[model samples]
Target: MRLAMLDLDSYLLRAFLTVAEIGTVNGAAVKLNRTQAAVSMQIRKLEELVGVTLFSRSSKGLELTSHGQIMLAYAREMVALSDEVGKRLTGKMIEDRIRLGVVEDFAAGHLIDILSAFRAQNPKVEIDIIVEPNRRLAKLFEDRKLDLVVCDITCLSRKPTLIWTEYLMWTVRSDFVADTEKPLPIIMFEEECPWTLPTIAALSQRNVKWKTACVASTLVAMATAVRVGIGIAPMMLTTKPEGCRTLDRSADLPGPVRIEIGLYAQPETAEGARYLVDFISRHTAILSS
Candidate 1:
């Protein structure tokens, strides 16, 4: 029996994923080093082959169709696997050492997966990855302890290479509900956490009384506190711990607020550091989804 040719072209998958990531065909074109018209044609060809409208265009740019969303996960996994195979076969992957820092916004398991993927492709690279709060990471980066960092910061002295805007919602224990008689119980980062004051201000603005249940040193400890009936705490959608969900925020609680994740790197950073920055940026686009 003869093997049938696959209808889904890898190039088209590349084009589709690029467009999905960048939110525009023209942007995808620039990223893929293809002309805008060529990128559009490939997208059309892909839709024809797949028999689904993959994107909806608008003034803001392109949004994925429902079908496109369904297709995206599979496309990304398949493309990632193919790329890994290519790297293994080429045996020419770069090798270097770098100190990288990431904010505690990532789910612990998800952060491992991200780093594992990078390590698998470039086995000889030495990575010293530190997971900490943005405040600490920013300070470390400034002190030259970190070569590259992906973190959320309220302000930066220099522009970031890329940024992702997100929102934080109040997350609470599975069975815990606010008691009006008592101040709301909560767990959060260290005192210097930029959100701590804003969280207080938001609740105070509405006369929602709250108290600091605990200021955990690590994200894990903070999450553990939230898991065990601690008061509501703000967390990014992607990083909420198990058995906890975003509160409805209808009961005088603060709603979600905008946050920014940024990639900062030294201009003279090692190749490994630069590659890790790009790697994190590409994978983090859909983090809050």
Candidate 2:
């Protein structure tokens, strides 16, 4: 027959992805509203179906096997597709406003894909986006002017969920060279720019001399300054700009601190905002370490 109708239980895939996301059977169990035994059984079923172990257990936590990592991608697409199809067929929609604030770095990249995916699942959801530095966004969050925020470690006081621990790197224009004899010339953002404090602290700790050559008030200005060889700037390793080159350790610059990108949700329904968070956490590499 038609290859036995080509079937695998989607619930097992959900269990697998959930376990991978939360990092523990117990955590996944609580999130999925299933018993520990039930979650274990589903994982076992999934492993058997795939003929490979999906997770390797350790005292630290469950780690995804290589096969598990590959499966996670397709698994998420399948789940999102299933959810989208069901929502579309049901024609049940929520038109609530979703006020979202995100860091400029993210707002320029896969944030579009993330929001598009969210809109696909939530057709009637009204999305209002505010793009700014994490410092400003944190203020909006505190004032209850926004429903959700994706920001850096400065706002960790909000007890937000950790998205990723991204490393920082020094970036310069392709042809520029570091000034070995003088204090390192630097391009920084506004005083409230989150990257500024950590970068300065790092250079200070290592006794690496640096001076702010330009304080760009916006990302475009910062990038433009770099393009014209104004000065080196600190940027997230994951979001390194295409035209700029990351400096090597030989440059004698102190390594920048790792930053934890996080998410905050308002106490109320925050319905559409929650959907965006789940989409990023599950669907994008934004949350990856």
Candidate 3:
């Protein structure tokens, strides 16, 4: 018997990709401007057409199945190609400027590489990026000084266009030993930093005796303090400096906090900003990993 040819619709593929990226039908619905039931039905229809279960629920939320994982790459390519073709045909490719704000952690990690690739693809598009704490970035976004912003979810009142979770660990120099008997020396970010309050609250709740050894305004300064053995500092796993290591369970440190990173765009953002948003959304898996 001959195998049947698959007739995949671009709309269905887009819905599948959106649901997979967002991890919930409701979230995908909000992003796609569709109802929850509509998004759910679209996912079901796409699964039926593809003849496989695409998503499975776990403690975290909806996760892609093995088949869905394979489909993700193809779906993204197809959807992006479709959008590109549509834009080309409609003469929608416009050269514009984008003012973007990002948290310092991301600026130190993947933001440079991401921006390089975006610039390579869009040479005509000009980008101005400000690296600051999430709280400061949120303020700039609110003032309409930025066309796009990527920051911690806690800093924003609006829904994010893209979101991912990362953990903050208690990091210290490799050879440094914490004196549990004495008050722990902690290197903390200034009050404007989003993680500062949470880190302090976690230590206080755990009844851990800690004193601020250094208060730095930048992530680089905080890392330097940790490396020089000033004190332990909370840092994302990806941004932890080479000389520093995270305190494990044996260290009796407070549990790491899961922070949600959000990408947000203004309602009337320029074409360049929208293009950059799409580019970042496509690269979320790589960025998170």
Candidate 4:
């Protein structure tokens, strides 16, 4: 019965916590890297299995019914526990190796400061910092190949907590302007970019069509394309590339596209896990404030 009740994936638990954090099936889908349909079905299945209505649709988004809210807290705790187990079981013992992965966007931003402080705090811990695509980074985390990742909070991710949200902006060359007919010539990271969904959604809302003219898997490639007028891209407001200028659409742009940067660790090792989480929490104040 226990085996039947909770599959290793804990899809129901993830779905519940994701809905609570993002406030919509679509949003949860992005974090989970699943389709909206898939997320909806998962939620439905979870609700059916548990025999409770977890959420109610709202104009703002999805609001948790009181029952949903109560369950959400429990679900989050369970998921965190699972991740802690993974963290503890994988890799060398805690003091020996601390493998950290981060998205390139943060390489130029506050990551350096954070790492520097971390090293100062834990002088004996060996840290390996890997810069990779968002998807790849998350995969490493899931595979227990990485101890922690400092990357944009992707909709597909179920492990990360909401650290902070960053404003999204469209960065284009100074001389670049969109033509009336063509969808913007987009230069994007090859399928692994985390913010790709928001970009697509914003364009869809504006009735602007777009095509990926170039696909480079790295931030540098995408930035180069934007600099040379390949296409405009939505970038984090906190960290903009050197030459790119913000584009003004004269209307409300898609949003304060919130980019959440978070940390992940195995759930079973609360002592070590809490240490890493607390480390991030302390330095994360700079971003939020």
Candidate 5:
């Protein structure tokens, strides 16, 4: 008896996963480094060989047909199997660098514990941690300079595949209550800080006069200013600086801003990317608890 040929190239599974997660042929094309037409063609070929229409297009985007959704479950399992096979053949999992960018506010909190866990799980993997404002972090991730980032964004452009929301609070010096009637002194990050949007919206709505007394590019500077009775700035409860406490301006501030923290990776690592995402997700639990 002759063995039938197998149309197996492990790359196909990864491509399929990207298309499903991103929901657009163009998005998947960017991840797979292929033209949109090429990506559509391969997906068509895969469906043809499998004898089904996997996805359907709509005004919203490419959505999985019921058949596609069912196949996605098996496709993930197949992809995992292929990775394990590759690892076995190589005698170890192939080492890769994960360039990670995060905002400084997270530095004072459980972010370190999350990184510690990730390092233990992936000891051979290298991580270059970049501490920057949310805007710069977004730019680096989009440019492929960073493989993953935990960003605080009101709305994300690259389409965060996974996200979690955290409550925002105001941090001010206890002594600053005396100047409540006057324009409040504000300690703020230079620009593009995640809290800036909500803070501005809150003050405008509350008819509060405010001016920046201290401007810094890093969270440390912002915390130091707030500690020395300089001004008020918004902070996440889990990430507040050691000496600072939340301001009791629930009435003056806009309802808690929902900071969406996310983990993003280029589409190629669709299978292995889960470990990093899960790590980040677990790390973010510190925010709520």
Candidate 6:
């Protein structure tokens, strides 16, 4: 006797993968823009077709079953290939344009290299990039003026497609000395910058006297200020300027700080936007490092 072959639906595979990644039907439904009932029905259908339970519920929510663990890899590949095929067949990918917004720190760091690699693979896809402060980027994203954005997560209210934790340190010129008796000289971005309030709050909570030494409109200007021995500023570890050093624990300053940066995109964005989002998500670790 001959065995029948199963035909898997791409839609169902996508639904399964989203739910697995998000770990809840409700969350997946919101991400997929489907009703909760529809996503639940799709998961049931996928489980039935596979003849194995995909998820086991616990107090923490859905946990993948052993079978689901095995299926996850294959589902990801299939869904990606399916999307690739659709894009290739329609020939719309080459004509697609993606408007992307990013915070200045990322733009000054590994963003160019990442974009270069992406452009090599997607040569014809036009990318218009806006480099701005996180608050401005978040506003642009909220207004739907950009297809995707990478900014400080604290500035945005929505769940990000991907998140990276960046370690921030109190940075100062290599030869700079602190006078404990005087108000600490501090470098700061404009008041609307996402880092400004937290930086001030941290100083205030520590009861450290601080006075603004330089008010910079951009990261480069801030770095220049630090290099010129203007004041101490919070800077990401991975992107600290060459002439600066982080304040040690013995220094009378806030302890080490961490901030979340995220890539944001709406679920209904265009394929080019989704492709860029996926590309960025895949290389997040390298970008952050």
* Counted clashes in each candidate structure: 1, 0, 0, 15, 0, 0
RMSD (CA, Å), candidate 3 to true, equals 5.0
Global lDDT of each candidate: 0.76, 0.76, 0.84, 0.68, 0.70, 0.82
lDDT of 4 at 77: 61
Off by over 4 Å in 3: 1-5, 11-75, 84-94, 204-206
Best by TM-score: 6
Error of 1 at 24 (Å): 23
Pick by lDDT: 1 or 2, better one: 2
Q: Write the per-residue lDDT of candidate 2 for residues 115-231, one digit (tens) a residue.
A: 876788677888889998888899898999888888986765744543566666788998988876798888876876777777778787778888889998876787788888889
Runs in model 6 lying further than 4 Å from the true structure = 1-13, 17-38, 44-78, 81-94
Q: Regarding TM-score, does 3 or 6 come out ahead?
A: 6
Pairs of residues clashing in candidate 6: none
Write down the worst ten-residue block by lDDT for model 4. Answer: 266-275
Candidate 1 lDDT score relative to the true structure = 0.76
Largest lDDT belongs to which candidate? 3
> Which lDDT tens digits does candidate 4 get at residues 108-170?
676667667766755656777888877788788788887667766663356455456666677
Per-residue lDDT of candidate 5, residues 36-65 (tens digit): 988887888778667788889989788889
lDDT of candidate 4 vs native?
0.68
lDDT by residue (1-289, candidate 3, tens digit) is 1215877899899788777756788877888899999989988998988889999998867889999988877787787778888877997765888899989889888677888988887788988889878888999999999999999998998767778888788999999888788998988878877777788887876788888899988888988898888998888887999978999765456777667889998866667887798888778876777
What candidate 1 gets wrong by more than 4 Å, as runs, is: 1-91, 107-110
Q: Which parts of model 5 have CA positions greater than 4 angstroms off?
A: 1-20, 25-58, 62-94, 154-156, 174-179, 192-194, 249-255, 270-274, 281-284
The alpha-carbon deviation from the true structure for residue 230 of candidate 2, after best TM-score superposition, in angstroms, is: 1.2
Query: In model 2, how large is the Cα lDDT of residue 48?
Result: 79
